[model samples]
Target: MAMRKAKVQEQVVQAVARSNPGDRLVATVHGISGPAPQLTMAFGFIMLFVVKYYFVTVTERAVVVHRAAKFTGRPGDVVFNLPREQAHGIASEVRHGRQWNSFRLLFPGAAKPTRINVAAPWANDLGRLLSALGAAAPASG
Candidate 1:
């Protein structure tokens, strides 16, 4: 099972790499006309597709959480499949939680939550995707 998961992850990373050969080679859009408009348009188009297609999956001993944040992945979307593990004390603020606005108590840890956005535009789509996956498993624990 782990090998299959790793293979799937590797394929995704390879696909992303192939799609974007140069990470920082974006063309400028403010100065020219015609083709320049296309450049700016391309940025939005590519980013949208990346957000829609990319997914992040994290698996622990008991449960697995999958997030599709793209470049803006949040930990909340991470579904907690197992509850035996304490909800706090981990490095993940979204998973463990943390303080917010110096008022809201999240996880009760001092360290700020690390943000690992997968880059999705909307959280709803991600939720629906997870729901479908969950239905298939129907979590035993």
Candidate 2:
């Protein structure tokens, strides 16, 4: 099982790399939307449903957010691209009230930060990757 998981991860990394030429992947976190019961009970069901929509790629120069239709049965979209220099930080929090674990990309110029409820299992890996990216982010002049 572990080997299979690793193989799948490799494939995912390769696919992302192919689509994002010139960018080197630093890390990836497979987001999970929680169990059926939790998803059904959550207010953000729609968003959570697509939590596993795509893998989040942290590259040397940018944070690429891609949405794949394979998970949603709808045409995918490139949600957004945040340059490392512009990202102020990455924040992860547990909303006890909602029983949600969320991750946000902070941008100084933006009024609101971009946020997502990170699937439970991938939380730690994602947090670490984002933290590394934050630390490595180019200083803004």
Candidate 3:
């Protein structure tokens, strides 16, 4: 009986995974390198750095939730949902962000997964982007 129950649970999880694949989560870092000609060259390096460290795509049975934090300058949490089998691998990367950390989990009782931390300079723009994404996610979800 226990084995039978386990098989059923496994099947259910597989069904969920087949329906919702993982998504990619990317956190772009932006800051001034210097000024002009010199800054332009430096900016290239900065972009490369950001691309290498922060280009994450949550693939295979996952959902991304962008959370907005009440802080300044730090990026908000971009949470990803993973199949139960893949959940363990996600924890480490989720906690190792330069500006923000993330975690993988099942749906919380009421909260969403992805979040963005807005800075004073970017508050207005970030707020709008988040709102738009939030509004759009429901239909996609």
**Which candidate leads the pack in TM-score?**
2
Q: Which consecutive 10 residues in model 2 have the weakest lDDT in total?
A: 91-100
lDDT for each residue of candidate 3 in 1-141, tens digit (9 for 90 to 100): 012323432433343344444432221121221123233346765543332111122334343333222122222344334343443322211222233222222334535432222223323322232232232111110
* Reference-based TM-score of each model: 0.20, 0.56, 0.19
lDDT of 1 by residue, 53-97 (tens): 223321222222333333332222322232214422322212111
Deviating ranges (above 4 Å) for candidate 1: 1-8, 11-56, 60-110, 121-141
Off by over 4 Å in 3: 1-41, 45-81, 93-141
Query: Which candidate tops lDDT?
Result: 2
Backbone clash total, candidate 2? 0
So what's the TM-score on candidate 3? 0.19
At residue 61, give the lDDT of candidate 3. Answer: 30
- Higher-TM-score candidate of 1 and 2: 2
lDDT score at residue 75, model 1, on the 0-100 scale: 24
Alpha-carbon deviation at 98 in model 1, angstroms:
26
Give the root-mean-square deviation of each candidate in angstroms.
Answer: 16.6, 7.5, 17.4
Candidate 2 vs 3: which has more lDDT: 2
Sorted by lDDT (best first), the order is: 2, 3, 1
- Sort by TM-score, best first: 2, 1, 3
